[model samples]
Target: MKGGPVLILGATSGMAREIARSFAACGHPIQLAARNVARLEDDRADLETRHGVAVTLHEFDALDLASHKGFVEGLPALPDIAVCAVGAMGTQEENAANPEKGAMVMRANFEGPASILGHLANAMEARGSGTLVGISSVAGDRGRASNYVYGSAKAGFTAFLSGLRNRLAKTGVHVLTVKPGFVATAMTEGMDLPEKLTADPKEVGHAIRIAVQSQKNVIYIRPVWRLIMAIIKAIPEPIFKKTEI
Candidate 1:
């Protein structure tokens, strides 16, 4: 393997799984971590068999705030690249009706992912080199009525990655913020997404792999999202609030 093992948090997710495969194909050792460790055993074996690289599985529950530190400490070895593809998007109506649900979405998208990355950042800083990839969303660029709860959380994560990238710029550790426009994942299974704007998991995986290799500070999975979000963000708040997305 060229680089140290590539650690993928929330490995069982569609996007993360594709990313794992992409890295494995490039001869990077793979460490897949998620709550469903058992379910990922077959995937681990497949990656090893297909890519001729080592693949290990670890149990990780993003919501378990207290375990974040131990999870990093328990890794077999520090990874050269770590990708945080951990997130949850609950229905906006449901989240608005339940404060707990809103909090859970917020924690899943921001707090939990941020906590683990924080620990990883410190470790990478100490080692003086590594890459951190955070899978934020284009939804973060603006708050819309359809999914403001999720959007707000992503906004926080985007900002967090930005700050981390700034701090680590001089420390040798690179931080990449990835904003995917619309991805067809289990999380958005039934949603009607625009075909032109939506990207598949594998496409996203490839984009991220390229970004990491090129050390891109920020990326929109489909380049058009940069323009789309730019237009959305430019709308005046007074006019924006009156329309539904």
Candidate 2:
């Protein structure tokens, strides 16, 4: 079904680009927002040319909380659907050693994302219609020692989305939390992700499109991740702490 304009935050990311393509192909006008406006020129042109949908670019800084309100206010129009794909997954060792780095990771994954989405949620609620999609991670389901710093931030974001969903349940604003396990993106380019568990960026994009259309509350991009995370979460803390996953 064709809908009104869809806004994608952190549009420069590999996953976000694919998401924009998915929605554009479905005849949805797209607004791409990122910290680097000039970087989106190619994307905007490509989307417009390929999908024949209006594509606009806007400057957005997730870390600049003060600019979020103004950023939303300056949008040409309130988006019918807004997706938050902003996040940072720093190395656990570095994060643990450098407090500032850890805090930056936390803010990027949770605080920055939550702050911006919170603004979008308020506007959407006031308008009495909209879908909010948050691209969280399965790492949030259980904090592993290897990536606890990044995982903890995602956990907070997951909770934020849940609470936002609950509060807006009766207000016509739908919230969808997407937990992707091992997405093959620039972020995980060098990591040795399991072939069976990993998903391509386009797959995630397509899954998100379907979820939004179906009004799904939460989903694991790859179904296997659901089972995998469940098993991880079920492990006894005493045993889980002893081994590296």
Candidate 3:
């Protein structure tokens, strides 16, 4: 099924752009939102031609909490499905130097994405139908010494999605929690990532689309991460706090 008109927040990012392409190919109208509309014109055009679908660019600022409601109200059409792929992974060293820098990590990963998705969820609930996908991370499963700043925010986001899902459960809206392990994108270009757990943008896109079709509640992009996170989360707190990831 073509499902419904699709809206992607953070559409300029690697995974979001891939998702836009994947759905556009299936003949769904697309609304892509990001900070720079000018930069994504090429992506819009490519998807429009390749899929013969209508592609519209929307200017969005995730951190602009007050603007989220207006942003959703202004959409040309109430989307059938909304996918949020907006998040940031700041350098742990830089985040440690300043609290202001650290705050951005929390806002970007949790506050901003949650604000938008929360707004979308309300709209869908009113309509009595829709699907919502929140792209979170496995790091949220537990805090590690290496990237707790980023991971902590994701943890909050994960919880928010869970609560949103529960609230909308009877409203006929489907909510999906996506936990991608390690992704090789501009955000992680220089990092050393293991081959076993990392996924490229295409793989993330594919997993999301399939999950949507299946109406899955929670999914780990690399299935093994489900096992890995289980172990990490199961570890005793005393030992976990002592070990460095």
Deviation in angstroms for 54 in model 2?
Answer: 0.4
lDDT of 1 at 137: 92
Look at candidate 2 and tell me the lDDT of residue 91: 87
In the range 69-178, model 1's lDDT, one tens digit per residue, is 99999999999999999999989999999989999999999999999999999999999999999999988999898998999999999999999999999999999999
Q: Which stretches of candidate 3 lie over 4 Å from their true place?
A: none
Instruction: Kindly report which residue stretches of model 2 are placed more than 4 angstroms away from their true locations once superposed.
Output: none
Among all windows of ten consecutive residues in candidate 2, which has the lowest summed lDDT? 139-148
Tell me how far the alpha carbon of residue 158 in candidate 1 is from the true structure, in angstroms, after superposition. Answer: 0.6
Question: All candidates' lDDT scores?
Answer: 0.94, 0.95, 0.92
Best by lDDT: 2
Better model by lDDT: candidate 1 vs candidate 2: 2
lDDT of 2: 0.95
Say which prediction, candidate 1 or candidate 3, comes out ahead on lDDT.
Answer: 1
Cα displacement (angstroms), candidate 3, residue 206, comes to 0.7
lDDT of 2 by residue, 1-245 (tens): 57799999999999999999999999999999998799999999989999999999999999999999999999999999999999988788999999799999999999999999999999999999999999999989988888889999999999999999999999999999999889999899799988989999999999999999999999999898888888999999999999799
On TM-score, the stronger of 2 and 3 is 2
Superior by lDDT: candidate 2 or candidate 3 = 2
Residue 45 error, candidate 3, Å = 1.1
Q: Write the per-residue lDDT of candidate 3 for residues 126-164, one digit (tens) a residue.
A: 999999999999988998888888999999999999999
